[model samples]
Target: MIRLFDSAHGQVRELTLRDPGQVSMYVCGPTVYDLPHLGHGRFTLVWDVARRWFTFQGLLVHYVSNITDIDDNIITRASREGTSEELVAKTYEKSWWDAMDALGVAYPDDVPHATQYVAQMVELITQLLEGDVGYKTSDGIYFDVSRVPDYGLLAGQPLDSLRAGARVETNDEKRSPLDFVLWKNAKPGEPSWPAPFGEGRPGWHTECVVMSLELLGEGFDLHCGGFDLRFPHHENERAQAVAAGVRFAQHWDHNGWVMVGDEKMSKSLGNFTSLTDLLDKNDARAYRLLVLRSHYRSPIEVTPATIGDAERALARLDGLARRFGLVALAGHHLEVKDDFSWSGAALELYEHVAAALNEDLDTPKALAQLFEALSSANALADGGHEEEARELAVALNALFGALGLSLVSASAVVDEISQALVNERDGARTAQNWTEADRLRGELVDLGWTVEDSPSGTLIRRP
Candidate 1:
């Protein structure tokens, strides 16, 4: 049986997927109001590892991460940015996609935007109302946690204890302090859709249940997110789904928050590091590698020095991979051995990682295994499998792929850049603009792709 950490229980729980041996997973996605950050990347890598280990164990994987387009934050950002709500959502969505691409994270099978599912959200909310689990507010609609009876089941906070967090003063129209909005009455100049709720928009919790039921179905394998989401967010979602007469998902997985310098990383706290800025200087694939070095469920405190160490470790991995001399005859499988304590320890740690991940996503322990694996791989490269390390490279890639940390080919796009420059220079030469051609050639050298002009043609290689 596959096991994953259930945030609801705060314990590793065994899981049984559909079709007797397959896992259908749905992970809660980002808010999309701002740029994706290192914290977001860490949570994504956690789920990535979950999907990968399942596949490694020969289980079919179907993954979906939702995009929340409509929200209070999105509205504020759209107004501030002087763009339409749709435009704002699209801008950040595209930026997030680009960031994920750079980080070597695999694209999900489906990424349905919440705005695109207004009808589904409306229908679900209506059904919850019919089930007596929700009530229509003066402004729009809300999920009455008092009706659910077990509203705080997932969070373990109970109804009374959570009153302070529900921000009841803000929503005086709600029937109870714990109730959450299902839909909001759209105001003038706001983005609205013609729904049963009289031209209002969907609520925050409505999207997940609707999208999950539609894509992964009521009884999907995993429902994963960050630990902070376990409260009103996931709890409300569970109530919404149950009230809609839909089957609830099996597992609830949530990663802990990332703190910086022993404080929660937050915008108000001024400790958050964004993905675009961080990745511009540090390599994304390498950063992903560093993230995978730790487990998903554990709290991470990202710092410049930590990221630098990751870059150094990634450089070592890349250097070792290049040393193997991957030949064009990449047709057969090979075995590898290691001698260094760290490298040996790292490989041996995989067993613990597998066991921990399968036990319920104990990410800290699993990450320990990854560090051990890296150590073992490093020592193996130096001692035992230095020459015959092809399999080691492949295994590292396969493992890293689960974490979405696979090293990108340095030659992949640098070739296209070279070709473009060459064409520019060759055109300049033909046009008798020899000065521009020389400048272009010099630019290529500055970018680390040495361009040598020869009798036959120009040759390009890393300087």
Candidate 2:
């Protein structure tokens, strides 16, 4: 069985499935107001890795990540751009998915849109009001935090402490500053849905509660998002579910933020980098590798230096694939129960990787084992153990594939220009003309080819 650090429990524990041999997960997705940043990429990739690992272990996973099509940010962007909210949401949501595809993230089984569940959200608000757990304010309907005894449970704070630390609200009618909006009364020109309270829309926190319950039913296996969402966003979601007397997710997991230096990357911090921009500039697999190099709950730095290191590491994996003529095993459903026809080093590699992953998804430790195996396989091949090396190479391919990273083999046919440069660099090295060799290598790099030295000559591949 897989174990994960449950945010609710504040420690790593076994992931107990609600249904035997099955996993149900809901990850909070982007709001779709702008292009997805690196933070968005990290969370999606983290969860995607988890889903793939679960499948690799022979357990069926039903993953549902919601797209927040309507939110304050979306409304603000639509108004600023003088466009319809629908168009803005549709356009940016496409960008979000394109980036996800570039990052090799698998599509969730069901992607619930907030706009599609408005009526259900309205019904939920009505239930809360009828139960006397919610009250109406002039601007909107608010949930009374005091009514939910464990309102700040996810936040790891008592209600009184949370209230004291909460930002002072301008709305004096609110019973406590911690009380949050359940429904926002629509403005004159904004989109609105008919509710008994008034013509308005659902609040941000209310949408996920209604959709997750509607789709995954009560007490889903796991709920996950970025660490930043653990507080007001996820806490409020759980509060609403508790007030309604419905069970929410059984396990809560959150991935750490993507950092730009000491600060977390965010639009407000002005340190955010577009995930699409990074994908365009570097190998998409490099970002995944960079993410895997760190613990899921530890912040990762994504600078040129870090990305360049990851790209070089990826080239080593690709080199291994090229050496043995290994085919990619990505996108194939290979369960742990399936016979792999393995023995010796290959079997050991698989067992070590599986053990690392099963222990709280320790990807960093797993990757260290993989790299060590990569070196050992190359050494075996050098020592005339060709068959053993090939077996290990094939196993490495399968293991990386299970992590959603596909290794590229050498190009069978390089363009004449790139081939000429590679030959020139090899000749320069043979002639002991170090300056000329360095210059030629720089040119090849400038042309978007990763240059590496090989026994045959300079090996080049598209990064």
Candidate 3:
């Protein structure tokens, strides 16, 4: 069994599945209006690791992550660029998937787009209205927080306190400051969907509740997102389910933000680095390794220094793979079942890693153990205990693979053109032509080789 810190309860609890041997989880995904930021990459990698770990432990995992294809941001971007909202959503959504692929995050079992679920969202809103927990205002339908007794449960605040601290809204039509819109009235020249409430689109909070319930059903195993979503977004989603007298998520989990200096990396902060930009500059696996090095619920900094550290750590893992001739185990599932075999040092290391992962997915602790084992395995091989070292190396490779970090073997055979470029770069450095050396390095990078400088010469390899 796995344990996670349930945000609603503010404590770590065992993950009690709705069905035996099966896990169903919903992670709130990106709203594609622009390029995804580092924060987006962090949350996605965190949940993807959790999902992979669940599967690696022999649980049948069904993962659902939703995309907000229709949002105020998408509409604004469309209007600013004089394009259709559909075109803007499609363009950025493609970019979102491209980044996900680069990060090695697995595609969800189901990706419910908000536009595709508008009809279902409307139906949910109608149910809330009939239940008298929702009210129609001048702008749109608002969910009256007053009606839901535990409206702020996920926020870890009482309703009165939440209202007291909430920012004053311009919409005086709403009965309470904490009230959230279920449907938004369409503005002129904005995208609209025909609904019973009016010709308007569904609100941001409404989409997740409706989609998660429809796809994963009531009381799914877990609902996850970034810590920022735990407040108003997740709170409102839970409120709607409570208002409608339906069970929502069984457990709530959230990962922490990516910090740039003291501020959270977000578009509004004007401090966000594009995720694609980082992927282009560094090895794609470096970001995933960075995420693993830190506890998921703790804020992480993504500076060049930290990224470079992760890259070097990955190189160390690759060195072990090269020495042992270990095959990459990524994209393959390893199940610890009844007939599974383990022995000696491999079994001992596996148990230690498993215990760490089962405890609230303590990846940092688990990784520490793995790296320590990596060192021991290298020492054993050096001491002529070849078979013992090989077994432990195989286990290490699979363990890291289970966490979605695939170790690379020795460098691939460099093409003649790339080899020539590397030689040119080496010659440039020898001749003290700094500008030419830099240009050659850039060319090699553009040719999809990770360029490094060794004592002998330029070392080029596929990342």
Per lDDT, what order, best first? 3, 2, 1
Better of 1 and 2 by TM-score: 2
lDDT of 3 by residue, 159-196 (tens): 99888888866577888988899999989999899987
After superposition, the stretches of candidate 1 with alpha carbons farther than 4 Å from their true spots are 164-167, 262-272, 326-353, 362-390, 407-463
Q: Which parts of model 3 are misplaced by more than 4 Å?
A: 262-272, 331-341, 415-463
List the candidate 2 regions with Cα displacement exceeding 4 Å.
263-272, 331-339, 410-412, 416-463
Give the range where candidate 1 is weakest over 10 consecutive residues by summed lDDT: 328-337
lDDT of 1 by residue, 1-463 (tens): 6766676676776786756767888888998889998778877766776676676666777889999998889999989988888888888999888887766566787898898888888788778778777778788887877776666779887787787676656666777767778888889989988876578888888888889888888688788888878877888888887666667878888876665777665656555479887778776665665656566656666766677787887765555454443322111111111211224433545456667767765555665665555566667767867533445455555444444444433443456777888778878877979899889989888878767664444545563
TM-score of each: 0.78, 0.90, 0.88
TM match of model 3 to true structure: 0.88
Error of 2 at 63 (Å): 0.6
Better by lDDT, candidate 2 or 1? 2
Best by TM-score: 2
